[model samples]
Target: MLIVGAGLTGLCTAVRLARAGLVPTVIDARRAGSGTTGHSSAKVSLLQGSMLQRLARHASTETVAAYIAANRSGQEWLLDLLRERDVPFDTRLAMTYAVTESGAKDVEAERQASRDAGLEIIDVGQGDLPFPVLDAIGLPDQAQIDPVATVRALVAELESFGGRVIEGIRMTGSSFTRPWMVSTTAGEVRAEHLVLATQAPVLDRSLDFARIKAYRSYVLAYPVADLLNVPQSMSLSLDDPTRSLRTASTGEGDFLLVGGNGHEVGHGGSTQARVDEIHAWASSHLPVDEPAWSWSAQDYHLTTQVPHIGAVPGTAERLFVATGYDKWGMALASAAGELISGDILGSAPAYAEALRAKGIRTADITETAAQGASVGGRLVGDRVRLAAPGSGQTPPGEGAGRVEGNPVRPTAVSTVDGRTCALSAVCTHLGGVVAWNDAERSWDCPLHGSRFAPDGTLIEGPATSDLEPVTE
Candidate 1:
């Protein structure tokens, strides 16, 4: 077995495979836990964001029950593993709250759906939270783990089980024979089975990439002296602009992770603004001297809210993928690994039906259409505003100029200083027209937080990669 990533999903799958008498080889572009998995908020709860009702609408009762059961079981399995391995984790009950009074209906619907699905749910009125909450539903036995520690433990076990983990190896692409072939920068790895668990599937072009929208969320860790009063529960808000809070113990003191400010990848505002907002919210909630760590993470959200697991659609016996956890990767990743491993081992999994079922399509056609409009709009808009190039006047920057045949289309040019520059005025992360930030000397994504240097290097990310340079 060959796993393309070394994150939670890949590591879990590797461990399972090894236990099942197969020594899987796991390879990562970077070191283990360097990807999205390491940066995750690491909430392991079955009470995902309004997902029960959504699952009830589309799936059968049995499927829904299996779905719930799988995640609940996964949580327990993780807890048992941690206990047996002596890995320190926070195993606490999780209460997902509906912030707005209007969200009461949705909360009720979710509770009912969970009940129907044979899962336990408790309603909280007062004294359940450190601060006042509108209404909250508590799910018993939900857990929170240090994702990095969990991955390290898993990796250690994997090594003990004779599984191989090779880091600093980048998989450029793949080729298929009877068994699939994975081509990495290090070497060629041929395996009877291949799993693409690399957050986003780098293979399989037929799969709708747009179906899962990527979102970047910010987290601020603060040390507060008063720890006992702070609830040891994981929480999520049901409001439009949602926020989540979880607490963890550190060597310094007890730290509260205040997370929110999510927006589509490459489509948010200043990164600093989002970080500051989270910090401010955390400060208001508790007394904080300074943020222990401030970082951002991107998650792929499926339209259906349930994770897409199992074989790649329309293919059999070869390639598989698991993605779109939607911030529920802790449980979802484990569930997905179990399902995929079962399929590999020729065993029937309880959650297979739910994993194989087609998910709700949430492609942003409007966003795509708007992008088309902006590209065309900017070309025409810029032409009318600025005069044609003259003898002495150069373009705005190194590559900021009109193409010869098509004056509207801009092209990126390389400056003598070895910087590749783009001519497009509109920031691709979001449709906000990017203005040059003189102080930073970069193009900032105004709608969501993404920054690009003058040469188009991604300085700060919510945007994973740099903007595509405009070509003639």
Candidate 2:
């Protein structure tokens, strides 16, 4: 069997399959744990902010309960593995808070939904946070860990079970015929079954990209002088431009992690400004000063509010896909492993059945339509803007990029660290115009979240190929 991607989902699924006596081969375009999993806050909890409440709007009570149960099982399995591998993790309370009256109502709805879903959550209004809050609720004993370390432990386990992982090799294309043939940057390989655990499945044939929306959130880590006053809990706010706070202990030092300033990828104007807002909030609210580290992660959300983790639609049973964690993937990634591996091993769980059993809700259809309209508008609008006279003539200054060329052929030009590179601006996946991310210095696709380095190398998202080099 072949698994594409080596992040949390791919590695976890590989470990499970290997433990079950299947030697799966996993491949990634980059190093293992260097993608979203490496950048995640890594909170393993069922009290996922206001997610339960959001799910309730699009699903039945039982479906939400099953979602929580699946995550619980996933959490238990992960903690067990960590203990067995001697990986260190901290047990902390996971919480959701609201600062505004409207946010408080949402929190109340979340509280009710969480309680109905069998969580022993408690009211911790205006919790022990350093800053004041209007209301809050928490679930104790939820855990947090260094996601990269956890990924390393999983890799060790997979290797011990004889499963192989190859890095820096990207899957370029695939043929779904019997003995499925997958073409990678390195070479072609054949497998009896295939699993795509990437952020979004790279293939456009399945139209899986249209089924979910892509978003990016920023995170900043600041050094704290007094650790005693730190939140010491995983907390998320329900207010606009949501704020997420947690404490992290690392070999370098202990730091307070402040996250959340999420927006649809590519569309979020001035990515650097998003980072600055988090910095401003952290400096003002917490007992922190200069930021020690800052980064961002991309996530996919479904209108159904449940991840799609089964056979790739239209790919028959030979291919499978797992995505749409909606930024609460620490436990959901493990759940995906269990569900997908169980399906392959013929012992899929009941929760997996429930996730797949739910019929499409009208809310889901409406949201999907809205997202489609937005995407269509972006594609057409971007093309028209790029086609205008004097659109891409002037060279961008240092640490900047612009889309050049006309409607028929667009070029992405950027100068970073004294080197200027020009490449195709059109995304390799579904032909979306790429936008420059000021913070990360990469070209980001507004259509499906595909990103590329300054040199046009594919970074992540559904794109399988790198941008073609353009002669200026």
Q: Give the TM-scores of the predictions, in the order they appear.
A: 0.80, 0.97
On lDDT, the leading prediction is 2
* lDDT of every predicted structure (CA atoms): 0.68, 0.88
Model 1 weakest 10-residue run by lDDT: 398-407
Q: Write the per-residue lDDT of candidate 1 for residues 211-302, one digit (tens) a residue.
A: 55567777888776776666677877766667787888766778878888787654443556677777776677655668888787766765
Model 2 misplaced regions, further than 4 Å = 314-316, 387-392
Instruction: Give a tens-digit lDDT track for model 2, residues 1-472.
Output: 9999999899989999999999999998999999899999899998998898888888887788889888998899999999999999999989999888888888999899888888899998777788778889999999998899999999999999999899999999888576878999999999888988887887655566777788999999988766677888899999888999888888888888999999999996799999999898888888888898899999999867778887876656668888889998989889889998998899998887777778888888999898889889988888878845434466688889988778778888899998988898889988999999999999999988999999998889998888999874
lDDT of 1: 0.68
Q: Global CA lDDT of candidate 2, please?
A: 0.88
Worst 10-residue lDDT window for candidate 2 reads: 387-396
**Alpha carbon RMSD to native, model 1:** 5.9
